[model samples]
Structure formats: structure tokens, C-alpha cells
Target: MIFTIAHKEFRSLFSAPSTWLILGVLQFIFAWFFLARLDAYLQVQTQLAMVANAPGATVSVVAPLFGTLALVMMMLIPLFTMRLLAEERRNQTLALLLAAPISSGQIVLGKFLSMVIFNICIIACSTIMLSILGLGTRLDFGLLLTNALGLLLLTACYTVLGLYLSALTKQPIVAAMSAIALSFGMWLIDVGSSDSGSAMRALSPSAHAQSLNSGFIFSTDLLFFALFIGAFLFLTIRRVNNNRLYA
Candidate 1:
């Protein structure tokens, strides 16, 4: 039953013209940035040639590539998330789902799965650009994998949060604005703080994602991502059940 609902929701994502347009633009940006970074690497290769045996030089070049992936996700997720529950409620389809035999948990999970699958496509498309970098120089394969994993977790968290926000509002624009604002606020707080004094930075998803992206797969980061996603999703299910009760 869950799979049936998830399959339906997944297919429905393609019905929007904006989804295709946004995807096209996102792919272009990924390709452009990867090439730009490659060109910069080539330009610096000459200077690097002079610094025979510079310590941790390879790490410096690779770090920014992973960082670029993080930047792309931060921008793309908000746009996708805005449409999740907000669009359904705005058009009154959420009530339809609530009235159906499906439980609130199943409905929320179905929507979340659909969004996660869409995100996988985006990440897969971006990999082509990253692959092109491999031909020019040997890149750290593990770093790339870690970077991708971090992005998936981070995006999942964003989707959950967006879904929760969408359930709280009837207006799609309001949901979008609130979700984006909250995400951006967390991002800035996480980034602007010093790592040494980052006791409070643990509250932000981006900070935790960065730790994982840097190949530091700490348990705290994993637990945080899981808890963050689970908490929001649980709240969404609660909201859906409550709405049905009052309706």
C-alpha cells in the first residue's frame, strides 16, 4: 500500500514544468562549476609544479570540489522542498490523502521517498561533471563518495523539515519562505562560528553535514542527521492526523 502511494507520488513530480526547468538549470550550474574548478586547478598546476612536494596540497584542491557539492545542495533543496506538502495543501489534495485509507505516516513517507528519489536524480546528473574532473587528474574517490553521502542525508533532512513546514501552513509561498529562512539562518549560524567554539554549531544541519563531507564520519553526525529527519517527519505525521481529526 505504501509502495502504491509512493509510486503515484513519484510519478506526479514529473507533471510539473518547473521541476524540469529547475533540474535543467541545476545541471548547467553543476557542469559549469565543475569545469570552472577544473580550469582553476589546471592554472594552478603550473605553480604547483614549482612547489615540489608541498604538504597536503592535494587535500586543498579536493576540499573545494566537495565544498561545491555542499553549496549546490543548499540552493537546490529549498526549491524542491517548497513544493512538497505546500503544493498539495494549497490545491486541497492533502485533504484528499487524509480522507483516504492511508495513515498519515504512510502518506508522509511516500512523499518523502518521492522527493528523495528526485534528489538522487539530481545528484546523479551532477556526477557527470565530477567525472570529467577525473580525466585531468587523480581525484580522491573516497572523498567524492563521502561528499555524496553527506549531501543525501542533508537533503533528506531538508525535505523532512520542508514537509513539516508545509503541514503547518495552507499557503505555499508562506511555507516556502519560512522553510528557506529557517534553513538559511541555520546555515549562517553554522558557518559564521569558529570551529573551536562551535559548541552551538551542533544545532545546525549544515555544520553536521560538513563534518561528514570532510571524511569525518562521526557517530554524532550520523545520529544527528537521523534524528533531525525523523523528528520532522514524525511532526508531519502528527499534523496530518490532527488535521484529519478536526476536519
Candidate 2:
């Protein structure tokens, strides 16, 4: 049942012109940044050779690329997620969905899975671009994998938050703005905190992602992402159930 809904949502996304435009623009931006990073690395290649334990191309280029993508995804995902449930409610289709035999969890999970699959495509495209570096230099596969993992988790967090917000309102624009504002607020927590061990900083997904961005994966960071995603998914499911009951 979940897969059925996911397939429907996935097809819906592809059918939309905006999805194509976003993908095109994102690919162009990724390519531009990759080239710029490669150029910067080349300029410093000779200097790097003389230094001991110097960072390689992966550290100098790929890591920063992932970092930049993280921020980009933080902003871009709300646009995709805004219309998930909000548009359905606005169109009076959500009540139809709620009346169906499928459970609320299935509805939420299916939509969530659709977005996850879409994000995987984005990550795959970036990974392919970075894979080209293997031809000219040694790439740290471990670090690359870690960055990919972090980005996936970070974006998943964004998706669920946006999904919940979408469930709360019939206006897609309002949901989008709310998602972006909350995301930025969490980012601000990470940025504004002065102490490394500050509890407030730990609340930010960006803060947890920093460790992964640096190629180190701590269990705590992984747990934080798990809890964050799970919490939002639970909340979204509850919201849908409420609609189902009240409809």
C-alpha cells in the first residue's frame, strides 16, 4: 500500500514542470561548484606536495562540495515538501485519502518514501560528478560515503519537518515558509552557540552533520538523526490520523 502511494507521488513529481526545472538548475550548480573546487585544488597542488600529512583532493574538494550541498538541500527541500499534504487538503483530496481503507501511517510513509527516492537521485547525481575525480586522483571512498550518509540524513530531517508542516496547513506557500524558517532557526542555533558542548547546538541537524562532513561518524550523531527523523514521522502520522478521525 505504501509503495502504491509512493509510486503515485513519484510519478506526480516527474509530471510537474517545476521538478524538472529544479533538477536542471541543481545539476548546473553542482557542476559549477565541482569545477571551481577542482580548479582551486589544482592551483595549490604544488604547495600541498611539500607539506606533510596534507589534505588530499577528497578533503579539499569533495568535503566542501558536500557541505555546500547540505546547505542547498536545507533550503531546496522545503519547496518540494510544501505541496505534499497541503495541496491535497487545499484540493479537498485529503479527506478522500483519509476515507480510504489504508492507514494514516501508510499515507505519510508513502509520501515520505517518494521524497526520499527523489533525494536519492539528487545524491546520486552529485556522487557521479565526484566519481570523475577517481580518474585523475585518489579519492577517499570512506569519506565520500560518510558525506553522502550525512546529506541523506540531513535531507530526510528536512523532508519530515516539511511534511508535518504541510499536514498542518492548506496553503502550500505557508507550509514552505514555515519549513524554511524552522530550518534556518535550527541552523542559527548551531551558528550562534559559542561553546562546543552547548546542549542547544546539539539540537541542530547541521551541527550533527558537521562531524559526518569531516569524515568522522559518531554514534551520537547517527542517533540524533534517527531520533529526529523518527520524531517527525511520528508527529506527521499523528496529524494525519487526527484528520482521518475529524474528516
Candidate 3:
């Protein structure tokens, strides 16, 4: 049942021309950044060769690219998630979903799964572009894998957060803006905090992702993402159930 809803939502997304347009623009930006980074790495290759333990192509190019993509998706995902439930509400179709035989958990999880699957495709595409460098240079498959894992978790965090916000309002634009504002605020908390061990900094998903971005995977970071995603998903499910009860 969850997969059924996910398939319907996934098909609905591709059916929209706007999804294709967003993908085109995102790919163009990613490619431009990738080439620019590759060129810079080539220019510094000789200098790096002389320095002991210098970062390789993976560190020099792929890491920054992943970081940039993470930031970009932090803002971009809300645009896609805005319509996940808010648009249905606005179009007066949410009532049908709420009244369906499926549980509220299924509805929320299904929608969340659809968005996560979509983002996995985006991440896979970006990783494939970065993999092209493997032909000319040795790449850190470990770092690449870890970074991909981090970004996937981060984007999933964004999806669930946006899903909850979408359930709170009937206006898709409002949901998008709220998600962006909240996400940016959390990012600011991570950036502005001076103490590395501060509890406030620990609240930001970006902070946890940065740990992975550095090619080190810690269980704590993984726990943070798991908790963050789970909390929001629970909230979204609760919200949907309330809507069902009222409707």
C-alpha cells in the first residue's frame, strides 16, 4: 500500500514539466561546478605532488562538489516537497487520501519514500558525474561513499522536515518558505556557534554532515540523522492522522 502511493506520487512528479525543468537547471549547475573544480585541481596538481600527504582528486574536487550539492539541495528540496501534501490539500484532494483505507502512517511514509527515491536518483546522477574522474586519477572510494551517505541522510532530513511543514498548511509556497527558513536557521546555528562541543551546534544536520564530509564516519552522526528523520516522520504521521480525524 505504501509503495502504491509512492508509485503514484513518483509518476505524478515525472508527469509534470516543472520537474524536468528543475532537473535540467540542477544538472547544469552541478556540471559547471564540477568542471571548474576539476580545472582548479589540474592547475594545482604539480604543487600538490610536492607536498607530502596532499589531498587527492577525491578530496580536492569531489568533496567540495558534494558539499556544494548538499547546500544547494538544502534549499532546493523544499520546492519539491512543498507539493507533497500541501498541494493535495490546496486542490481539495487530501480529503480523499485521508479517507482512504490506508493508515495515516502509510500515507506519510509512502509520500516520504517517493521523495527519498527521487533524491536517491539525483544523488546517483551527481555521483556518476564525479566518478568520471576515476579514469584520470585515483579516487577515494571510501570518501566518495561516505560523502554520498551523508548527503543522502541530509536530504532525507530535509524531505521529512518539509513533509511535516507541508502538513501544517494548505499553501505549498508557505510550506516551502517555512522549510527553507527553518533549515537555514539550523545551518546558521551550526555556523555561528563557536564551541565545537556546543549543544546548539549539535542540533544542526549540517554540522553532523560536515563530520562525514571530512571522510570520517562516526556513529554519533549517524544517530543524529536517524533521530532527526524519525522525529519529523512521526510528527508528519501524527499531523496526517489529526487531519483524518477532523475530516
> What lDDT does the true structure give each of the candidates?
0.76, 0.94, 0.94
**Could you tell me every candidate's TM-score relative to the true structure?**
0.91, 0.98, 0.98
**Superposition TM-score, candidate 1 onto the true structure:** 0.91
Provide the global lDDT of candidate 3 against the true structure.
Answer: 0.94
lDDT of 3 by residue, 202-244 (tens): 9999999998998999999999999999999999999888885
Q: How much lDDT does candidate 1 score?
A: 0.76
C-alpha lDDT of residue 79 in model 3: 96
Superposed Cα deviation of residue 246, candidate 3 (Å): 3.5
Candidate 1 residues lying further than 4 Å off, grouped into runs, are: 50-62
What does candidate 2's lDDT look like per residue over 1-247, in tens digits? 9999999999999999989999999999999999999999999999999999999999999999998998899899999999999999999988777888899999999999999999999998999889899999889999999999999999999999999999999999999999999999999999899997899999999999999999999999999999999999999999988885775
- lDDT by residue (16-124, candidate 1, tens digit) is 7887888888777766766676677777777777896852323554556656766666666766667677788778887778778888899889888888888788766
lDDT of 3 at 29: 99
